[model samples]
Target: MDVTFGFLLLFVATFLVAGLVKGVTGMGLPTVAVGMLGSAVSPVTAAAMLVIPSLVTNVWQLLNGPSLGALLRRLWPMMLAILLGTVASTALLVEGDSRWSGMALGGALVAYAAYALLSPSTSVPGRWERPLAPLVGLVTGVLTGATGVFTLPAVPWLQSLRLPRDVLVQALGLAFTVSTVALALGLGRLGEFRLGQLGWSTAGIVPALVGMALGQAVRSRISQQRFRQFFLAFLILLGLELAIRALL
Candidate 1:
């Protein structure tokens, strides 16, 4: 596709916003970026462009956390399952229509955001975590493959674990990093992720990093609860717009 000035501007703006969200909340980079760009580009293209930024940012997030080895030991099954599930479902990216992808993305976003807003006090029992982890990973991987959004059950399930704040953030980083890599590999196998696309994706890292820095700078000043509410509300509106446009 031709990368016009307008498109480049849109690309930068999209990632900047996405990175800011991630910086503030320690997640949402792919979800916000893909959802915003899906209207202007193919879902495949949007997902492709986000590869570098999402991977880089999430890896940074992952490494910054305290308990890498333990988290990996505990979460490996789920992480491996996510990889398998994403690879298994990648054909859908090639075969699915844009409208279907849009609807699915919209639905995933709305469902996740709505569930988050409800803030249910649900927690997974210790006995169930082992079995449930793989199931959640597989389902999240499928959704990530189909829609390029990995927040739904994955984020919610992670929250249920009730890890300490910093550990939870790091865990999110690890999960998102895995999801981003899986999506990149899936796109690469289909020949949808090209050198030219990688160039653009690489360029996005600058804006994304800048946005993240800015967000982090201001993070302490704002009420995280209020900001999250606003963010989730914005997602619901964006998701509704995408779904409505696809259906019409």
Candidate 2:
């Protein structure tokens, strides 16, 4: 939109920091960036800027791991529901007023922050997966369509699948990749997906990869324990600000 060098710098730095978080903790790229950037830009703009970087990083995440065929076969039902819900809901979101989408994004941030702060390791029997996953996908898709954030029940539900840790991480990447692509299609249909934004989004990938390298190098020294809690607190504050901004 504005296309200022200063804003581009801010964008790069934000992704650098966000990518560091993802490298260290296996997530938070979009959440951290969107939460902070949303303070300066509209939620929709933040989402737009996130499009390509999100897609690329998540694709790397998905492909770097093994057993893609199995994860896809097993997870297809929920994934399909996610795509369906995204298409159905995002068309409305893209065409209607944006304030509601802004407010939705803010609320998603707040809810995610609070959940990360409070939730403990949880478990559900595998028996529940079939019945529960589609519901989770539907809700996650609707939220992603409206707000461009997609954690909440999806992450927890994935965890509940009792997948190995590596596979779980890859699963997240796969799901997020699907979400980002589906979102891009919706944005394109709405005529909000511009080539310039994609260019900037592509440029952001470099800083993100650099940050990922830095994070991996320093992972042993960083106290990932406290880092997460602090991140959640920061997000809570930012999310509140966004929600307030949306209301006003």
Best by lDDT: 1
Backbone clash pairs for candidate 1 read: none
* Residue-wise C-alpha lDDT for candidate 2, range 65-92, written one tens digit per residue: 7778999998988888787777667755
User: What is the lDDT, from 0 to 100, of the residue 43 in candidate 1?
Assistant: 71
Task: Please give, for residues 69-151, the per-residue lDDT of candidate 1 as tens digits.
Answer: 99999999999989888877777876776577667767876887787788745568999999889999999888777766777
> Highest TM-score, which number?
1
At residue 121, give the lDDT of candidate 2: 47
Tell me the lDDT of model 1 at 95. Answer: 71
> What lDDT is obtained when candidate 1 is compared to the true structure?
0.80
